[model samples]
Target: MVVHALHIRPSRPGAWLLGLLALLLMLPAKTPAVEGVEGELRGAHRWSGEVLLSGPVLLSEGASLEIAAGTRVRALAPESSLRVQGVLRVLGTAQAPVVFATPQGWHGLLFERPELPQILRHARFSGAAAAIHAQAAQLVLEAVVFEGCDLALKALREARLEIQGGRFEGNRVGVDLELKSFAEIRDVHFVDNAEAALLATGGCRLNISDCLFQGNGKALSLLQKISGTIHANRFVGNDGALVATRLGAGLDVSGNFFEGNRVALASNTFSQPLVVDNRFVKNETAIASDQFSTGEFRHNLFQGNQSALINTRRADPLVTRNVFERNQVAIFCDFASYPQVRENNFFGNQMAVKLGTYQSAAGARPPGAQREAQAGANGPGPAPTFAEERPLQDFVDVSANWWGADTDLLASLDEQGNSPIFFDRRDEAEVKSQDAFAAGGPIDWVRFRPWLIAPVADAGPR
Candidate 1:
């Protein structure tokens, strides 16, 4: 109390405290809140149970929707989906791959929009009807494993699929192409499927390069009017390597190594396909065609096959410039169908060419006997002793120089040691004469005929 009516100011400490309280009142209150969208198990907010999403859950730019490794997602009944109408980029490493499996069978990722973007790598999807169904969208998947699914990648109706370095195993069908879709499958492995490893239907175009197809029921099957280019691929240990039917056109199969398959190329009637530049080793039949189907067999190497290089019922193929080596019987033309044989190397086979009663007796008759018989019947009136038909036109210009066990024939002639003996007929002996087919050297025996069989037979280029 001031007796003289004097009012005193507050202390400096009191003023400072009042000012600090006023500053605290002006500041906004802070609370603990969720940071990102729900259902993601990372960051502050983690969701459990089925995540029923009505709208697309977009992640932050440059951020990935990462499902933790060894984590399983169980979708709710009648609502089993994680539909991404936008982009769903999953980045999984080899050791820790993200899994999108359900408690029961369901759909994993349904990409609906045409412009939806998705990138899935090193991920696993199982127990789903379709692991990944991309419709009219662009999908880039690599190092992914798909199992227990009907179809691994169902790219439908103008969708594009570029799959590389992935494994599609234990699925009904590995990759199903439909309705003008385009797919480029490279560096992939497909095995142990009930149906075909890669099935292309609905006029699609599949370019399979540098891939391995092994232990599958049917490796690659093409139906409808689809066109496929299978190049630089290895098909081994499959039931059937390739089966194309129903008027499919523009199938360019080249530079692919086919080994140990049951049937290499099986084409039905009305399907004219091109099979060129492929190596067929130890296959049951390299090519088998039937009834009005035309096959172009060119620049392909056929070795160690059990049956004919080309076994056809009625199709007259355009066979040109192919090498047939060590096969059992090359070119078995059955049912009166004759392939147009031209410029092809027929050597090292058990039987180079077998006409199978298709060629006429006159055409099959031996060359030397025909001339002798005409002269004998016209003037001498005595028939020749040997009358056997030899293959002539079928082997237009076949060189036995590289024939099996005949490589020595060519070397002897080059050395100029001795004039090799060529037998005109099978019932001949080795005689030292210049007129024979030599083991190695070039000699025209048609002009000279000394001891007919001995000189021609023993004089082979050697």
Candidate 2:
């Protein structure tokens, strides 16, 4: 009967197909951009093969967050690493110097912030493995320029580094403080490193100031346990500038300037150094200590070293008030280490003290049992002897001393009766007549003893 409900409009064909699908979803959906290279950047839900800028770019620990600087990051491979987590900020300067290179060579700057606070300034971190591998964060190297990085700043574990004015070159180890780190190097410039220009280990706590350890092999290598405070530094032409080993403890080497080093201050065994007011020149061995160590040489200023000061074998160490000049062998005690020589200020040294023989007279000391009562029997003896009344208590006042080169202060004496001695010399017009193989040489013992009062310039605890 009513075969004509032909006018059945259920809201006009579903409201005209829901208003044509809301005007085609408000019209605007066609994003597919990709261009980089002028201070590059990418990542807006990246996916054009998940956005990568050529070569090794596998950074997926929370996917995508690559920042750039004036941009020049080129590492086609060969230890490519820029792997960060979440954030990266490469802001550079000093004439725009942010360049982490490598297609065949160029390695530097690798931070893995485990604690945060990583900064790199005026960057130019060169040829890698290290120019910066500071894990456990808190690094702030300014004016960075570490070149040929084989190891030019690798502070691991609790790192808290803060190097300023850097320039470490040809590295093998120009700053490698491992575990428990706490470096604070200032005004850096360690050049030509083959081994150490600064290699502290384990219990590290360095604070080297005004640095310039040149031509390094060992400019400052304190292994095992280190503790430091080397000040106003400048150890040049190094072979072994300052090598404290084993249980190395608190070192406070002050006012440094050990020049032409071949061995400027080598302390082996369980060291406990405190060498003060340093300025040992022309080093061949300007203070070498072995045997079980413990040092405290004060007001240092030994000049022209050619094997000047080497205490061997053990005990009694604390040579005070130093200022030995023109050294050829200013102090060399062999086999039986006993060094408590006080009030030092010997001039023009050829051999100011070369005491030897602790065992040789067919091993003397048995004619009735007293070679000074068996050299006052105490630990460390038996074929390596010396220690005949050492423990020398303070004998200050080296009589108006200004002992600088005046030539021949006892030349050569090594078989035993240590000679070449010069007891006192307060101020012979601040001694500097200049002729230790002249030609304008030898006479700048702190500019002709400016006004002598240098027991480390206002002695410690200030």
Task: Give the top-scoring candidate (TM-score).
Answer: 1
* lDDT, model 1, position 47: 29
lDDT of each: 0.62, 0.61
- TM values, all candidates: 0.63, 0.34
Model 1 alpha-carbon drift over 4 Å, by segment = 1-72, 76-79, 311-313, 354-462
Candidate 2 residue pairs in clash (backbone atoms < 3 Å): 107-127, 107-128, 358-385, 399-426, 400-426, 400-427, 401-425, 401-426, 410-420
Encode model 1's per-residue lDDT on 119-157: one tens digit a residue.
777878765677777778788888888876777778787
Local distance difference test, candidate 1: 0.62
TM-score between candidate 2 and the true structure: 0.34
Give candidate 2's whole-model lDDT: 0.61
Q: Which whole-number lDDT from 0 to 100 does residue 1 have in model 1?
A: 21
* Model 2 regions more than 4 Å off: 1-94, 98-110, 113-133, 136-154, 157-165, 168-176, 180-199, 203-211, 214-221, 225-241, 247-263, 270-285, 290-303, 312-325, 338-348, 356-462
